[model samples]
Target: MRKIFTTIVAGLLFAVPFTAMAQVNILACEPEWAALAEEIGGPKISAFSATHARQDPHHIRARPSLIAKARRADLIICSGAGLEVGWLPILLQKSGPQVQPNALGHVTASHYVPLLDTGAGVDRSMGDVHPEGNPHIHLNPHHILPIAAQITDRLAQLDSANADYYQNRYQDFAQRWQQALAQWEAKAAPLKGTQVVVHHKSFSYLIDWLQLRAIASLEPKPGIPPTSSHLESLLQQLKATPAKLILRTPYEPEAASLWLSSKTNIPALVLPYTIGGVAEAGDLFALYDATLALLLENANVE
Candidate 1:
């Protein structure tokens, strides 16, 4: 009887440490935020992204599996400013109070960054224009540290015991990220003032950061699919000004950009707009590396 008692107590002691190591659950609205959370939270958190590289953040459906994840989430991270307007509200409604809007557990990356394309004259006629500005803020590497700071604060608040761990992680990530940013800027020097056309405004932040000029978009308006008439107009416009390259995300249909490229002799390139968008862009640093390499390869620098 004493031997049996000793064995049971030993088993219970062994299980205690595993139970104590339970991770905080994070439901990130996009893959970039999930990757960012992983950087800050390290092994103390389990981060999951609702949208993948090929999925359009603007149009995701709030499916039942997502609702299940939301219910279990200790925190939620997203790029706000109406980027996830289609489904985030529904997820918030079904999620715990901790992750509701304005809650400490709810972190919006855009709220911490200076947004573009804001102000009056926004209407449905504008075709999916975000009144709060462009939410593709992750494309600008400079915007990352601020958002990482915010995330670290939230992680500390959520799990005070691991606060120092998160802070140390953020500091290390910041140092490496800053070094990468400088290198990227130096390598991209030749791309400044280089004119290009785009399938959409998806890379506005990237273009703005690199000082590249966007001559035209395949789409006539935001979120609108390209039409024959609009493409013909863009063809005429480019004939006069002559853009160096045409850009599009992996998820975007290639028809419009390809058609334009065939006529103009300008190369159409697909940029991995987020983490996992391309095989090479497996992480945040790699995302910028791949982007700059692609631009430099095709750029007509003097």
Candidate 2:
């Protein structure tokens, strides 16, 4: 019995080193990307989110701590298309890691999904606009299916020995995710044609999914904050449309939404915007599930 106990203890000690050596490090720019990384990576990944789910990605500070995390990453993922335009370049410069475009550590999930609002024109006069398009594709669950697959492929490239593991997990996740997306679409279908004024261009994918038209915005342009005149003008146009919903993210100012909601009776929905943005949206699937319910509920409320 004494020899058997000693053997068991020795075996446990041997396993600990193996587990520590086998893990992959992931550094994601946002929570949505971090959540996706966790899904595909399972227990073999250590993922870090540069910004919280509730913060606006456009305004994040490229602090020293985030750069330190990036330097140690085996893989770094981000929502490209100018979503992280404000801080990504600074991270690259400060981390000082030469991650080439084709390197294993460099991955952008945006390439996996089809982008919306690509046709929107950009000019400084129109405020801070993404020259590529709206970078908030994660708002719509339909886009997540493809994005997951892309990340799976990326993980395989970075850690070829674990390629099969990533692929298996991706296939399983895709099946479940597709079912969730289907339910959301069906639930939100009734909201089709609901005119909404988005605080930013963040919900272009959601607007496309629900067939909701963006009549105007609280922000005069893409990245600029709303002016008094802009809000006043939008209020006038939307006052008569009682059913029109105003979509705003968790980080956006509630003052404008509150004012419009009071004046025009439009319920300003402070949505999760991304997974983990709110306590209710604890995971990737819950974020969309919650958002769809809110938008649909408000559509019928008036």
Candidate 3:
């Protein structure tokens, strides 16, 4: 009887820690947030991105699998500010209380970061401009620390038992991230004031950070595809005032940027806009490293 009682007590003791160590399932609206969550949450969290490096976050189908993942997620991290306005609300509705907007488990990075291009009154005629402002805040290295801090706070809240662990990890990540930001700023010095064209406004944050001059975009407007007339106009414009290079993310169709590049004799640079955006961009640190390297390489920097 004594031996059986001891065995039961030991089993309970082991089970308690195991249950406590169960990983938090986090559903991130974009790849950047997912990567940041991993940096802060470490092994205590399982981060999943709704969009990949190859997919445009501006538009995504709310597939059943996504709905299912939301349903099971213990927490939600998203850019908000209308970036995922199309489908995230639907996902949240299906996800139930676990990851609701106001719930403790839900954290939107945009709420914690300063936004640009705001108050541009909503007008369908203006193309896909977000009335709330530009949602690509992650590309700005300066904005990342605040977002990471928010993620850490939420993680600590959800798993209070592991609060110290998450905090410690955040401190280490913050230190490394600050170091990387300084290095990136110094390395990107050459790119300052370099003129470029883009497929969309996606690079606004990076452009803003590096002080790169974005002279024009392939799109007629925010989300509208470029019409032949618009492309012709751009070609004419470039003749008078040429840009250094044409820029686009890996997910953006190359034909337009390539067409412009060939006609103008300018290089079309496809940058890794996020973690997993390109082969070399496997994480946050790699994302910035690859971006600066690509921009520098295109500018003929050794």
Candidate 4:
């Protein structure tokens, strides 16, 4: 009996270190960052997105499931810049010190990228404006590498034993990503100045990256939903200026864009806003591929 107990204790002791080194648990605020984490961390990390592509990150609730995930997370990756101001703080409160803000495990993608639509005074009247600039930074393929590097560095720092492994993975991803960037830029050359209307600023980075001209938004303000009056005004505006495409994310309601499209004969396109937003956008690379495809397909619509 004594010998069996001792063997069991030894076995449990051995399992502890193996479990500790199993994988770094990452909790990402959105699907895009979660996909980026998977690209950089590979098999060494376990990543879960708190918000899926079909949901708006700005309006998530800090539910118990997310809190539970946060508590176990070794790292937290978020867009930041107050994008998740509504729910992230609640998750952070329930999370451990390791994943808290300013900690090694905390990575904010906005910190590493050049922000757009900044320096504007924010107020409720302006709708859901982020004073820290736009948080939807992932659409710009140019911004991915820096964020990927930051993720790699954070992963290496958290799991030092796999530092070399992470570095090699990052180098490979960087190479493939750079190649894709070239291809995307070349393919998107024709869309450089294509005029379009948007439902929201969700695709600001994407529009900027593709050099597409955004004539107006369906939403009168940043986070405000489109009203009948606003849509009528947009109908009048588009009839005069005449944008070729009406763009919206999968999560946004289709009513406004479709209404305007019906009136103006503009093609309303639903670009996948993130991974899983559309079936074709199953991963990071696929997300951009699908977005560009949709944009190009509708770019010349009469």
Point to the candidate with the largest TM-score: 3
lDDT of 4 by residue, 262-289 (tens): 9988989999999998899999999989
Q: How close is candidate 2 to the true structure, as a TM-score?
A: 0.88
Write down the worst ten-residue block by lDDT for model 4: 13-22
Say which prediction, candidate 2 or candidate 4, comes out ahead on lDDT: 4
Query: CA lDDT, every prediction?
Result: 0.89, 0.79, 0.89, 0.89
For 25-120, candidate 3 gives per-residue lDDT tens digits of: 999999999999999988789999999999988889999999999999988999988889888988888777758887888998899989987864
What's model 1's overall lDDT?
0.89
Task: List candidate 2 stretches off by more than 4 Å.
Answer: 1-21, 96-101, 124-126, 240-243
Off by more than 4 A, model 3:
1-21
Candidate 1 Cα deviation (angstroms), residue 273: 0.3
- Candidate 4 global lDDT: 0.89
User: Using alpha carbons, what is the TM-score of model 3?
Assistant: 0.93
Question: How do all models score by TM-score?
Answer: 0.92, 0.88, 0.93, 0.92
How many clashing residue pairs are found in candidate 2?
0
Worst 10 residues of 2 by lDDT: 94-103
Task: Using TM-score as the measure, name the better of candidate 1 and candidate 3.
Answer: 3
